[model samples]
Target chain A: MTGLLDAAFVLLILTTLVLLGSSRIRLGIRVLAVQGVVVGAAALLLPNHHVTLRVVVIVLIGTILDAVVFPILLLRALRTARVERETDPPVGYTASILIGVGLLTACLWGMKYGGITLPHEGANPLELPVAAYTVLAGLFLIVARNNALNQILGYLMLENGIFLAGLSTAMEVPLLIEMGILLDVFIMVMVMGVALFHISRTFDSIEVGGMTALTDWPDQEDVGK
Target chain B: MIAGLILIPLVAAGAAFAIRSHPVRRAMLVSVAAVHAALTARLWVDWPARPAPVLDGWLAVDAPGLLFLSTCSALFLAAAVYAVGYHAREDVGEPRRDIEEGGLFFRNEPEAVFAGCMLLFLGSMTGVSLSQHLGLLWVGVEATTLATAPLIYYHRHHRSLEATWKYLLICSVGLALAMIGNFALAASIPRAEAESGRINLVLGDLLANARALNPAWAQIAFVFFLVGYGTKMGLAPLHTWLPDAHSEAPSLVSALMSGALLNCAFLGVLRGHQVCTAAGFPGFSSELLIWFGLLSMAVAAVFILGQTDFKRMLAYSSVEHMGILALAVGCGAAYGMGLHALGHSLIKGSLFLTSGILLAAYQTKNVTKIHNLLADYPVTGLLWLAGFLAITGAPPFSLFLSEFTVGKTLLDADRPVAAAAYLVLLGVIFLGMASAVLPMVHGTGPVDHEPAGGQSAPPGYRPPLTMLVPPIVLAGAVLGLGLYLPVDVREVLRDAAAALSGGVSP
Candidate 1:
């Protein structure tokens, strides 16, 4: 079980790096879906003394939402917005890949040196570090990408990272709360997808860089009349 | 009983969606708001003492929550009444021409969507106030973000679309971190407690087990909570979405966001602070809040200094008052924070409502272009001037009392320098806001006061009583509270403040 979990963690890291390096939105979505599936698998594989029917059911629903439902939504948005690839992110793909690797290394080092240890000694050692790396990489994706769709992808990565972090912890959140969290995430993605449609229609492009009509620069155009 | 408080509006929201007639939908909005307010008032009377946790300790009517809940309920009623008049002017069920896009026509979002979202927004805020479990509170806060996004996009223009996008994305991300904070908090439980399945994120359970918590994880949770909820609360450095959303959203939505939604988020932050205090780490959270509060105030002061747009300027003022709330809580002035929260909400809600009237009359938000407001619209202009005085902490308004409470606490704590900085920032903000507001209210009207291409007020336009009464009533409440807080209200404020301060002081 530990070996399978470690393999899942490795897959999560590889997928995150691939996501950072890929410019094709479609391909990026695929990598994110794979990462989501691995994360769901990891939730089950974690060494738990008691794994009930509830856990299995939640894992199934979560996998479907994160992997299948989310990607389908993003793909529909992609086709409707009529964009194929990220043309010019503020940060290049190579630098982004390097940055992802650096973040992964930093997370490993920090966990090892920072004396961060889970209460359950039998928990996999790699869980915390990998979760931290995924979170940072997700945040970096959000900041470095210019497309609204890419940012939404980044937000999903961030959410997935948080989910993994919970699995790493010893705490037992109630199933109801877990479901509430998942439902909130589901609605959130739907809202963002709808907003993306409006952005594309109103601006003729999904580049957030062009959506600079609202700003606080001292000399910006007056918004009054 | 508390479940009904949350369910009534949510169920009404579903009804609003199914209803066909716009007038009927609007009536539903107002009637539900009135019922919600009456129920909230009934809460005070029924539990004249203290109410126990309802729903298996998942929801409770505590001092701080009640204060916030009442404020939200009152403000929603005011916004609901004001919305009726505003929407009538807006010509619901008709495709409105886009003024920003040079005569291009854009259909307004369905009035049903607007009313439904507003009701949903109210229900979520109610959930936020009543939630005793951190996870439930987080759900409530996120729901508010979702419910209000459609409201902000009601106009269907590019700018509002942009505002809605920014608001939805930024707040969603921020609340995600807050979810992580909830996990961290669960992790902070002692191993024994975890093994016993006592790891739910309920406030009472967490506080009871505070001494056994791992301080390291507890502190980590507070940081996440501060950043996450602070982003929603419009604390500076994380307040990028605020001005745009507030300025661009229809003014009634702006009023609700500024007046009510921000308080719900602040309550989230304070809940985290309560846990930290129970965990014997008050100093850590206090230091962080004080610094963040000062930073927010400083940021608001700078932007407000020369702001030309009246709505954005009011948005910045909301940021500044949120700072004062944080600072007061940090200084252990819970009573003052409660008083200030009440005052600021009513004053700011009235101000935003009045700004809508001004917008209707002038068709412009630029303060420079608005002249002779007092001459043109006496009631709105008087309300605007009074709101300015109240918000800026002028004498005999609740804001003045609240600011003074914060200042006195700072001085009492031997933090003279912090106290001085607080005063200096307030002074600068007062000057900044006064310059913009006074000119708009009292400026002499030139021959061509209207901006180029600005449409004159709709022919024979007179401010409807519904539009005028809410602000007057809101501002009037602030004046009354400032002059004399009723004994029960004073007791509630003190209790709320004491709850936040861990009963250290009244």
Candidate 2:
């Protein structure tokens, strides 16, 4: 069970990286959805001999929100905005992957220095490795993505990594906080959607670059009129 | 009583929203401000030590929380009064127009909704400052951001919309990161003690269990908390959204942001510092804060020097003062931090309010065009100029006394290097702000062309006694603090500072 969970973690990171390299917004969202599923499945594999029905319900809700609902919302927003190609990516694909590798290496170094050894008996050695990769991959998404929509994806990726970190002590967070977290993310996505719609209507583009025009030097015309 | 400070504005805001009559809505706002001020005054006089009501140890308030609550409540009352006059003038001067042909801009009606949201925003900020639990604090902070979003978009212009979007997106992301930090903090607590679900992440509990917290995880949490709250606090590197938001928002809202909102966020950092100190890592947190604070000062120096927009210049000045506040706290000077925080709150609040009046009078936010301000509006112009002087730490203002206190503390701590650095930064900021501000105050510039409609001022240009009173009162308070500190007030300041320093003798 632990081995499968560790493998799922690695898969999540790979999916995050793939999402970062993808120019198509739909594909990015799809990749994120897949990563979320892997995370949910990994959560299910945690050691829980005496899990209550309440816990089961919570895990189910969390998985459904992370895996199904969030991605659909992103997909809908992407389709509505018609933002298929990320023309002006913040960082190139190859450079981003390389940076991801460096980040993963640093994560391993950090974890090692902190002396965070897994205590769960029979857990695979790959647990730490997979965890490190997931976190760095999330960081990559955050740094490399230029579109505001994609940045949200990156944010979720980082969140997924943080969630994975808690697997060592799973079931610690209350169901309510977990729910609140999911609700917060949903609201954030909705607000971002509204902002994107407004931006597109005003600027004729949904690119994050459109925002750069906001801070332009004040024109005398504006002052005079 | 703390709950009342938050609830009164909230309930009044709802009432204002329901009432369509402009005059009634305006009256509601005034009454809410009056009631809030009265309650705050009561709290100030009593200085009651009511134990914070705990939700399973999720929230509580201590001394600092009470202090911030009082400060926020006081500022909110002042701004609420000012807003009534501001919106009334706006309504009389410029009626809503159909400007759809231009772009995605709409001339919003001057209805009660804006005033209502303004009060709600004020209430939410008060809630945040008084929150003892980390989770409640997070909710309060996030609520403030949401409440203020509508206020920023009040004008419904393309620029206002743009500013609102930036403010919302950046701050939402930052606050989300802070939430992640809160979770990490929960995760850092030891599980060996065996609670039912998760260990409650209250400040006091965290402080008590500091020794057992995972150091690495705690550090990660601090970083996120700092960045998240720091962004809201308008720290450098994360303050890109501040100037635009402050400049575009109504001047009354800008005053609240500069005067009140930034301090609320600073309280978040202070909470993190307390945790860090308890975790035996005071130096780490202090160093990080000082680094950001100094960086913010440097950023402000560059921007304020060449700033042409008067509002943006004031916004940058806010960044500079926030930097000084952080630096003073980081210096670990108990009295200095307490005095600086309170003094900055008063002076900066007055300055922003004065700036609002100037913006209304000149019908422009440009510094270059508005010259000989004293010639145009004597009382406001002189007050505006004095506000600038006071905010930049000139003598005969509360800020001067506070800055001097911080300087003395720095020197006494045997940190001449840090003291000198602070002095130099202060001097540079003063010079930069003076150069940008003095010209607008006294320089002779071309007269503004009257509107085609034959209005002498912009449609909403009336500066009523109500609009003028708050800043006058605040300015006098600043001057009074500078000239004399009452024995009781001095004692309170000492107590507050000592609280920050873990009850160390001042």
How well does candidate 2 score on lDDT at residue B375? 67
RMSD of each: 2.2, 3.9
Could you give candidate 1's per-residue lDDT for residues B169-267 as a string of tens digits? 788888878877887887888877776877567887887778888898888889999999999999999999999999989999999999999999999
Q: Estimate each model's TM-score.
A: 0.96, 0.89
| DockQ for all candidate structures vs. native | 0.58, 0.33
Where model 2 places Cα greater than 4 Å from the true spot, the runs are A47-55, A114-143, A165-176, A179-183, A216-225, B51-58, B92-106, B109-112, B194-199, B446-461, B503-506
| Candidate 2 lDDT tens digits, A32-117 | 77887787677666653235675566557767767788887877777777778787787987777777767767766766676765
lDDT of prediction 1: 0.87
DockQ of 2: 0.33
* Backbone clashes under 3 angstroms, per model: 0, 4
Off by over 4 Å in 1: A218-225, B50-52, B445-460, B503-506
